[model samples]
Target: MFDLLIQYEWMRNALYAGVIIGFISPLVGVYLVVRRLSLIADALAHVTLSGVAAGLLMQKEVAWFQGVNPLYTGMFFSLAGSMFVEKVRSLYRSYQELAIPILLSGGIGLGVVLISAADGFNVDIAGYLFGSILAVDEGELTLIAGIGILVVLFFLFFYKEMFALSFDEEHAVLTGISRKIINLLFMLVVALVIAASIRVVGILLVSALMTIPVAASLQFTNSFRQTLIWSVVFSQLAVFSGLFAAYYLDWASGGTIVLVSVAILLLILAVKRIVRIFRRNPVS
Candidate 1:
């Protein structure tokens, strides 16, 4: 199964997409977890689903969209949805989390309508739900790679500011970090990451790719930067293992990946408990 990367273009594209998502998802996800805004990824992913559904429905109904890729539309709507969330958050500052549920519901509603219009779900749409080994084409691999680079560069450039905002928004504001601008930019970056990851992880489970590894990492890390590093490490482990399982065992890639992530988190908790018990009762 591993050797297929050299033998098939589809396998190579899958590997590339997985690695890109492995790196960026947890990298950005660490900050999201710290800020207690992890649900935002789920909301944006649902929005992306609407866009993807629209693209698929259009391909079926309109002649022009036959040649168009659904991922492009997914990215556009994800970005727009991120901005909408930001606006709604500002409108109800005392209840900021309301925005995520609102967007999530709206996205799911739109996606259902579009999918129904396209005559219900088919194999092509199933790929976006549970993921497919061959779902990503050459162009999408290139786009995912490009988006990975941009996300890394932006994260590095705004590392300190992001940290400040994540840990203490009031302090970030006091430090003149331009919280509004940085937050909007971060949301946009996160939206792009979600759109890019859906090719491999699928829309429904992509949030797990973002948050589960971070949850596991928090069990072992003492510092914020260290947490980010561990999250990416655990993410790579899940991605690689899940990809291997999906390829050889005929499993649904998204579900396999998320279940692997959950397994890792549980393993980490068990390990930490054992270590604490051992320290408390050192042998003679």
Candidate 2:
């Protein structure tokens, strides 16, 4: 199985991209989860699907677009969607959560229309919807690497501000943190992560990679830093194991990865339950 990496360029690219996404998704997800903004990832992912469909449609009808990558278009849409969400949220201050569902519905509707227009691209579209290990190419790997670096830098420079905001928005604002600017930048970063991860986990399942590992880490972690560390560890474990299972079992890579993360979460819950019971009974 390990030999596949050295023997096939696609395999190597998938591995590299998966590792980068595995780390960064959870890195950003920690803050989102703490702030109860996990749904934003799902919304951006649906918007990205529309962009991908648009790219596919152009490729079919336009000569110049034949050489363009759909992932680029998907990234553009994801970023645009993020900005829209922020704008809408501002307009509905008392009902800010409404922004996510509105965008999610609009994105899905637009994506369906674009996909219908493209027609005859079921196979290619499936790759974007459910993920294909073979779909990743060298160009996409470079894009993923660049986005990964940008996410890292954003976190490094604004770690404290992000932390403060996540735990207590009101106090953070009083402390002079620029909520509006930070939030806009954070949404953009989330969009980038969703776009970069589409090849590894697809648009439909990308949010799972971002949130599930953080969910698992929260079970045992006592500190914010600990949650971040454990989330990355669990995410890497899921990515590597899920890729191996997908390769050997011929399963959808996105589904397999999500199932592994879910399995990890269940396992942690079971262990915690058993420990609680043991603590109550002790050794007679």
Candidate 3:
């Protein structure tokens, strides 16, 4: 399975993109999960889908002029959705979660309309919805790397502010940390990672990459730093294992990656339960 991956350019690109997306998703996702923004990732993914659909729709008329990349369209839509979420959250003030259903429905609705109108031929709409490991190429791999590096750099610079905002938004504001600015920044980062990852993880399963590791890591670690470390470790495990599985079985990379993460999460939960039982009464 491993040898087969090295022989093909598409496989190589898929693996590289998988690792990059693996790191990028949970890196920002950990904070989102901490801040109770878990569903935001899912909502943003649907928005990315809408973007792809919209982009593909444009391809019908301008197929001669513009060289369109679905990933770019997905990024544009995701970014717009991010901004929309931020604005709506601010507008509601008292009901932030309300932003989720509003944007989620809007994205899917637009995507459905676009897909139906275009007869679903503008792009491989399924790829945007479920991911396509085999579809990755050198150009897309480069874009993923660039976006990943930017996400890492952003996190490095604003670690403290993000920490404050995630742990306590009111406290962040009290400390003059500009919660609004940091939140918007966080949303943009989320958009960037989601768009970059859509090829490998797809819109439907990408949120799993963002949330699963964090969910598992919280079981064993109480410290935020430790949680981040474990989340990355689990993410890498899921990505590499799933990549290999997809290569060998011709399965969907996005589905495999998500399943791998879910399996690991379940394993961690089971072990934790067993450990608790053992600690209760260890037989001599």
Better of 1 and 3 by lDDT: 1
**Using alpha carbons, what is the TM-score of model 1?**
0.96
Which candidate number maximizes TM-score? 2
For candidate 2, the TM-score is 0.97
Q: Local error of candidate 1 at 6, Å?
A: 2.0
Instruction: Give candidate 2's total backbone clashes.
Output: 0
lDDT of 2 by residue, 173-220 (tens): 999999999999999999999999999999889899889999999999
Off by over 4 Å in 1: 121-123
RMSD of each: 1.3, 1.2, 1.5
Whole-model lDDT per candidate: 0.89, 0.91, 0.87
TM-score of each: 0.96, 0.97, 0.96
Ranking according to lDDT, highest score first? 2, 1, 3
Worst 10 residues of 2 by lDDT: 117-126
Q: Number of backbone collisions per candidate, in order?
A: 0, 0, 0
